[model samples]
Target: MDAMIPLAQFLWLAGALLAAGLATGILAGLFGIGGGAIIVPVLFEVFAAVGVAPELRMHLAVGTSLAIIIPTALRSYAAHRARSAVRADALRRWALPVVLGVVAGTALASVSPDRVLKFAFVAFAALMSGRLLFGRDHWTLGEQLPGRALMSAYGFGVGLSSPLIGISGGGIASVIMTLYRVPIHQAIATSAGLGVLIAIPGALGYVLGGWPHMAELPPLSLGYVSVPGAVLVGSVATLAAPLGARLAHAFTKRQLEVAFGLYLLIVGARFAWQLVA
Candidate 1:
């Protein structure tokens, strides 16, 4: 299409997109954290360069990020499943509530102001980073709560947050599980499985919500999800995810968490700067 010619001319931009995806994919697989921490920021920069409106920029970035995550998570999940690391029971218990929350969150996103959503996302990132960095020692999942309630609460929070922030929901879920004494590896594996569930509905919701606004976007887009961007990013990410999973075995659990925590802090600061600027 005529609209795509300009984008095609910018080969360097395309390379940047792919490289960002590759880095994020490795991080996602290694830490069991969704690539959202990396994806969102990169997307924001890319979209801005392409002249996307400020109001829709973050939403589109988040939506497109979720779109790519669907495939990446599925690929990672498959690999983790093969290793017998996925906690199916936990996934089943939390599925319903999480799905419900995803729908609710996505619907809310469709109508909410962009500024509100961005602020909320920043708050979430800060909270999650704090929990990972300082609260790790005090958290524990007691046997006292019913499985359904625990799953629902955790799933709902993840679902609600994913659409709003364009994250894969793995980081928060893993952190929660770790606090409750779940082995770090199992939590990471299980989070990958749950990420698929979060991404599916959330991605769908974004598409539907952004459909009316599609004509406003640049070429190679489906609503707020940029098809080209997703394709380029998702492809390499899928291949790299398994390698990350394999590397996960090399580090002690504490070291992995600390590394991930530092990553979060860095990412959080970047987003905070974006918000302020």
Candidate 2:
């Protein structure tokens, strides 16, 4: 029955994608995570079902996921801002370096080998898990390490790495803010704001870098961004994200942290296995 369906059956696929996206979107908003943790795996399966090449599958998954995150992140930021969780002062302070870092990272990704990218993502996920598990009880020094210079360095590292893995830089942002003893609410809000910074250059890089190879892609694709898929997923995610923000208010901060940590562990394990295979 599955084999009989046409690959481009847009409506059915869109419905399924919308439902899945909504669920993940809510999780993203509530947990202050980039939806990439869920989106990448699902997108990989979706692209495979549509016959995307094995070699290009990860690239497409990452690109499309990042593309959708742009708007989703913006919507999440707005929602958080409404609650006064977004610290505009901090965002302003970090913006320049984060944007610059994203541009540099995106440019670098264009020239880097795919294997290196994959390995880097796996390593990142592992490191994140280790930090969360073992360092949960550790308090941040909170002494402020050279202010803007330190932030720029962290921002650059996050910008350079997130797009390559199809994320919105939220995970890294959360960790950095946590280590600096930023309040959880403020950390989440700041991370959402950073998503916009990350997505812009990352999306541009994917489009430009992958353009020459366009002829090899599936129909209706703009470089690596799958327009139809992005539309379907982004729409639902926007609507669902606000609900997640509401849910966040219902849970204790510590509980939310544990839940989010476990979620990352599962997703990280899945991606690691995929990379290994």
Candidate 2, superposed: residue stretches over 4 Å from native: 1-16, 26-34, 82-84, 238-259
lDDT of 2: 0.75
* TM-score between candidate 2 and the true structure: 0.81
Give each model's clash number: 2, 0
Which 10 consecutive residues of model 2 have the lowest summed lDDT?
A: 3-12
User: Compared with the true structure, what per-residue lDDT tens digits does model 1 show for residues 72-157?
Assistant: 78988999999999778888877888888889989998888777667767777678667756764656767332467766887898
Q: Rate the local accuracy (lDDT) of all candidates.
A: 0.79, 0.75
Q: What local lDDT does model 2 show for residue 195?
A: 95
Clashes of 1: 2
Model 1, TM vs. native: 0.83
Against the true structure, whose lDDT is highest? 1
